[model samples]
Target: MEAKKDNSGRITDWRSYERVLLPSIKDLHRLDVYEENGGYQALRKVLVSDDWTPAKVTDEVKASGLRGRGGAGFPTGLKWSFMPPVDPEVPRFICCNGDESEPGTFKDRQLLEYNPHSLFEGILLACYAISAGTAFLYIRGEFADWITHIEVELAKLYEKGYAGKNIMGSDFSVEIVIHKGAGAYICGEESSLMNSLEGERAYPRVKPPFPAQKGVWGYPTTINNVETLAAIPTILNKGGDWFASVGAERHPGPVLYGVSGHVNRPGVYEYPTGILITDLIYKVAGGIRNGKKLKAIVPGGSSTPILRADMIEGVRMDAESLKEAGSMMGTAGMLVMDEDTDIVGFLRRITHFYHHESCGQCTPCREGTGWLEDIVSRLERGEGHYRDLDLLTDLCTQMEGRTVCALADAAAWPVRYTVERFRDEFEARCRPSLVPAGISI
Candidate 1:
């Protein structure tokens, strides 16, 4: 099949000949428009037909090999299977983590706004699979527009018997409640989100009893990202093999990449995984803005390590490939930088964000993030010392494994990567000629 580029000149048909998860549907946010485009067909197929049992629904997802879109890339089916056997006496819950707080990550917000029914359908299927009676979607408070979009569709569902009790005239009933977060970055974490939803401070809880074991309100629960669940209805409508046939072999599925920074066209593009970084930047995102040479690219979200332009060569945008490149496929937020970008100054801004967002629950994250911020701020202002580089590296090493969560590690990666890859720039700033007099050698 020939590849077709959309009106915006993006290749609609990428590695996969089809668009499964994110199809080009007009007026998709509305319930009527969604139904016209085969929106709730999957839900009806599973709910009305006796053939699709809850176990079958999970097995199909397992076969499809869908991974979590929220950074970790954990298999979605495997996560659902982790829940303990459902007890009729005790209710299970599903929490949709719609808080897209990661820097440069906004794909979830699109799903929430443009294709909300897909999320609702996916939630219904998940509720059935896990025997969950109650489902809560925790949207970030800042997404006022997205909140309005989803709430409008949700009201339609309740009116049409697609949500609320006795869904689609079946004995299975699921209740979905929308909860807005208090705009805390830490609340993006699943455990912390649960804490926030329950009216507690947004600090991550100890995880010996993982969410599947004990979650919101201290009950059996499962949490999935908006993008992760959004893929479910597609998997159900099409067989699992069809879903797995596209994208990278190991992590086969359509993936959404949010391109920002110095890209010519900064928008969310959905393509099968395993697409080369260079291709996405050049072909998809229209290369470096203003035809400038590429300096670096954050292959995933800000949490992942940065990749020098040279390192990005021949690198496929998938979980394992990005990991092999000493980074991660975090939220797939591909942030590109051009020749004029200042590595030290750029990373200092990132350091400030993490330092400010650290929940202060763990000593290492609480203190280490502040130290990173101070050091990077100094480096950006040309007040850095030669010895400060080593101190910063040591500080990052101390923060990585010692924090209660990955917050400290996220704060450390850009600092470490920018210093390592673009050391000449940082070193130049710390030179005796550049350092101010009386600043101490």
Candidate 2:
């Protein structure tokens, strides 16, 4: 995969591209190969160096300008800094969210399958920063292959004296446990993931005390995304300025963009953020499938607002740029649609996902998602009334920012954006044929 240097376009010269989070290393799956290629060296340096304290680690992360790759784009170092003073007597925890169930997003599965040890190295670094003794790697149940890969790598770490106590003959020790989720989308959320990890129903919790303050069995817990934590060791090895210099300033560091849908090559591309949408689709992703003209794009995952081809001009694939373009760089899952694609049918498919995934903990999300799905289904079947469009928008407005989690808002975003952008298609779907002038049915 090539990298994007600026808004100008994709850089085909792969030799010049900086691969940090997803670095290319030979025999990457093997622990010995990983260590030989400079893996776990950061952990050893931190464990031994007097200058490498938890505060310094957090400061370096902050300096790097690394943001959470898990949709929210929250500052990772700021989140780690929120943890209370690490006490030897008190227990702190780190939960690595691997629940990669978001529609159009599968980058985490790539990292877990191909480069499992990078994740472990990241978990170790995060544990050091947050003063965590135990780290839980929460993976979704559907990802059996990924889970197996992680389990195998974890056993190797244990055997190599990398996971257990007295690691590398140092007092700093940490344990990593892998937990498989029951295929719930809500479990991807930090608070909800903690609940699922505790063997409770996977429902989102209200945020008064955020996860950093009290998470997972009432401890000072910091939950990092799989990609966010996976990039930590790289940030530690290279200076923070180097990491910051790679991507956009606001959201720096390497980003894994999972391009799907009408793209000729639908795979995860590890490129720096701030690449233009046009360059990503055409240059990196091998353009539209079947040589069809571009129609629309879901810049992020299914939950993000849909963007018409015209709206994509000069739009960089970053948080600030997308937000300014009336969308978000959510999960960096770009789903392209060609000219032949059915916009109304696409809306129906996405609405169905949110409807099925609603945990029913919040009234707006529970009822609102179902309502959106029903209206969309009716429209698909040519049974929709003219007022249904207005009704759908109203329901989405009511649901946005009202639920315990962003699931409701996420559910609402694509609906409102699609309706607002492709109103003609939605209107045409509602009424199969226009009534003859002055001729009543």
Candidate 3:
């Protein structure tokens, strides 16, 4: 499908692109329906064929340029390769991070709700690739309805012999388990999710003995995002080159853009990566609600640095482009804002979420998030002083890169970026200091 572009060379007909992750097929959640539509064929191909080995599966995905759909855009196949040569006596595990707890990130929820079998197939493929017999699908506790639906569907897979011992009548046998998280946002972090799976307190573990080296139950494990795993089936069905050629050259493949906030049609839209921010806002999402002018955008999830309207002029929704534009392609969960939005109040609410969700494991995150919430709350109430802006920036430096996990960094980003990017808006809300220039507090 040829996309129509404006004079500016921006793709106007984004709808022309095919949807891979969230296809429009009906009853896709059902096993029979999924099978009818070429689902699980990838897994079968890998398991039954002599040509498609575990190493081959990893190599194909690596060729696809598939990155982690989770916050970090790490290469998916490279991650699977990290699993040490499988030991028959020892157990290796695949943890599917279905904890869709990141604010503004709801695409994974739709995947589980509408087309769960893809994720199941993806998980199985991952298990085969990593030489693991078991895969844990860790979902957040808040997705109760979807969890039940997934469990029901999973039972159907087992009954059909798609899962369990000698799946598809091949020697390769695997078990898929659905794990419901306690709704802790920190659990979305890989190490923390592993801890929760082991029935321990959900806390971020230090790296070095990283999950690939030492994971849940201290076995070699590979933790992948729900969307990341779900994309695997497609990579195998179509050649890896086909998938890689679809999107931004570096970060290729279709991505689920979860657009929310001021857009009129706020929901998940599947399109190739590197779609222009403007085309997504105007063409796909039907523009700003009520014709309000654009103000700012939290291009990725809440943790990604917020961008001014001008900053996104030529920005594309991919890791490299976003990074060059001073933001990260974090979940591609775009939270748009209108001209009338209260910048200070908006940031206050975001700060509150990170503050409440901090696992309290590290002092930087534990104490820093609380302090951030307090300062932002003060600014939102119009009680903040001009020095509070500098203080907020200072607190971010202390919190960022200091915590065990990125929780502290997540909390600090919006505050630091918002304060710096929208300094005038924040300054307008704050009371000016009475002290003379260069006066110390």
* Residue pairs in collision within model 3: none
* Each model's lDDT: 0.87, 0.89, 0.91
Kindly report which residue stretches of model 3 are placed more than 4 angstroms away from their true locations once superposed. 1-13, 435-441
Highest-TM-score candidate:
3
lDDT of 2: 0.89
Q: Could you tell me how far off, in angstroms, the CA of residue 367 lies in candidate 2 after the best superposition?
A: 1.0
Model 1 alpha-carbon miss at residue 308, Å:
0.5
- Model 3 C-alpha lDDT per residue in residues 98-175, reported as the tens digit of each score: 898889999999999888999999999989888998999999999999999999999999999999999999998889
Model 3, residue 23: C-alpha shift (Å) = 1.5
After superposing candidate 2 on the true structure, give the runs of residues whose Cα lies further than 4 Å from its correct spot.
1-15, 432-441
**lDDT per residue (tens digit) for residues 1-441 in model 2:** 435455533332333686766677766877988888899999989988998998999999999999999999999999999999867787999999999888999999889877888899999999988889999999999998879877988999999888879887878789999998888999998999999999999888899798877899998899999999999999899878778877577787789999999889999989878888998999989999888999999998998899999999999988999999999988998899999999989999999999999999999999999999999999988889778999999999999999899999999999999999999998887864466699875
Residues 1-441 of candidate 1: C-alpha lDDT, one tens digit per residue: 555544644333475346555677887889999999988899889888999999999999999999999988999999999999878888899999998899989899877767888899999999999889999999999998788778888999999999988988999899999998868999889999999999999999988799999899999999999999999999888778867866677887888889999989999888888788999999988888788999888877888888888898888998888889888899999899999998888888999999899999999999999999998889889988888888889999989878667788888888887788788888888845466778885
The CA lDDT at 270 in model 3 is 93
Measured by TM-score, how close is model 3 to the native structure? 0.96
